[model samples]
Target: MFKKVPILIFFFLIFFVSFEDLYSKDEYFLTLRNEKVNLRQGPSFDYPVKILYKKKFLPVLIQDSSDNFRKIRDHENNSGWVHISQLSKKKAAIVIEEELILFGKSTIFSNPVALLKQGRLVKINKCKIEWCKVKTGKYKGWVSKNGLWGLL
Candidate 1:
C-alpha cells in the first residue's frame, strides 16, 4: 500500500489542476448552444429564471462559475447564471454599433463588402489587432473589432 499512496496522490493532483483550468474565471466568451436558454438569478435550478434568451449564437462573457453553472453577462450588461451545457466554445460576436462596414480587407481603404446592422450575429473566423474576420449569412469579411461584443 505504501507504493500505491504516491500514485493516488499524483492522480488527485492532476484531476484538481485540470478542473481548475477548465473553470477558471479568465473572462472568456461563449455563445448560446441552444435556441432557448434560461438565465437564472443564481447558480442552480432552484434560482428564479431572470431571462429567457431565444437567440442562438448570442455571445456572452463568462464572468464566473459555480458547480455546472456559469455566471454570464450579455451585450446589454444583463448578468445572470446559465448552465454550462447551454454554452458553446464556438467563436461568435454581435455587432454592437449600428451600420458597421464589412471590408474586403482588414483596412478601411479596402472595398466595402457589406453593411452590418446592430445586433447582427457573426461567426468569428479570427481576429488580429483591431479587426476580426467574420461571417454572417452569405457574407464573409473583416470588421472593426470595436464594433463587436465578445472579444477579450
Candidate 2:
C-alpha cells in the first residue's frame, strides 16, 4: 500500500492543476457570436436588458461567469452579463488608437494600406511578435499589436 501512495499523490496534483487552468480568468477574450445580443443586468434572462449590441464579431473581455452566462466588458468600458451562447472564441479586435495605419507588411516601413480609426473592429487572421494581420470590410493588412485591444 505504501507504493501506491506516490501514484495517488501524482494523480491528485495533476487533477488540481487542470482544474486551476480551467477556471483561471487570465484575460479571456471572446467575440460576439451573433449580430444581436442582449447585455443584461444580471446573469439570468429575468434581469433587465442594459444594452442591445448590434455588431457581430465585436470583441469583449470576459470578466466573470455564472452558470450559462458571462460578465463581459466592451471597448467602451460597458459591462454587463451576456449568455455564453452569444459569445464565440473567434479572435477579433477593436482599434483603440485615434488613427491606426494598416501597413502592407508587418514592418512599419511598408506602404500604408488603410487608416483605421478608433472603435473600428477587425477580424484577426494571425499575429506575430509585434504585429497582427487583420481584415475589416475590403481592407486587409497588418497593424501593430500596440494599437489593438482584446489581445493578451
Candidate 3:
C-alpha cells in the first residue's frame, strides 16, 4: 500500500495540469463581467474606435495571444479583432437572443460562389484575424465570423 501511494500521487499531479487544457475551446463561451465594454475597430492600443456592444452580452473568444487584442466573431458571422479590455471571465455558449439568422452560402465543392445563394446552419471550426472557418454541414469554408453568437 505504501509503494502505491507514490505512484498515485504522480498520476494525480499530471492529470491536474493537462486535464484543464483538454477543454480549451474558444467561442464567445464566456459572458461579459461588466455591464458594457467598448468595441474597438482594431486589436491594439492605438486603434480606439467606439463601436456599440451590448451590456452583459458575450462575445466569441477566438484566440488567446501575447497581444491585448482577443480575436472574436460576431452574430453575423463577421470575424474581427477586439481589445482585451472588452472581455470577461464569465464563460458561456451562444443562445438565440434574437430572430433566426439565415446563412448565405450552401455546400458545393466546385461551385462555392453559386452554393452561397441561401443561408444555412454552420458549425464553427476556428478563426483567424477577421475570418471564421466554419462548416455548414456539407460545406466547410470561411465566413465573416459575425453570424454566430458569443457565449450565451
The TM-score values for the models, in the order shown, are: 0.83, 0.85, 0.39
Candidate 3 lDDT by residue in tens digits, 1-152 = 99999999999988976776654453334444456665555777576655555645454556544377766665456455666666666433342323323233432222342133323334556665644555544656655444445423
Question: What are the lDDT scores of the predictions, listed in order?
Answer: 0.96, 0.96, 0.51
In model 3, what lDDT does residue 117 have?
32
lDDT of 2 by residue, 27-134 (tens): 689999999999999999999999999999999999988899999999999999999999999999999999999999999999999999999999999999999999
* Model 1: lowest-lDDT 10 consecutive positions: 19-28
Kindly state the number of residue pairs that clash in model 3.
23
For each predicted model, how many residue pairs clash, with residues at least 3 apart or on different chains? 0, 0, 23
In candidate 2, stretches whose alpha carbon ends up further than 4 angstroms from where it belongs are 1-22
Q: Could you give the C-alpha RMSD of every candidate to the true structure, in order shown? A: 4.8, 2.9, 11.5
Model 1 over residues 54-103: C-alpha lDDT tens digits? 99989999999899999999999999999999999999999999889999
* Order by TM-score, highest first: 2, 1, 3
**lDDT agreement of model 2 with the native:** 0.96
Best by TM-score: 2
RMSD of 1: 4.8
lDDT at 137, model 2: 93
Error of 3 at 18 (Å): 18
Cα miss at 23, model 1 (Å)? 9.4
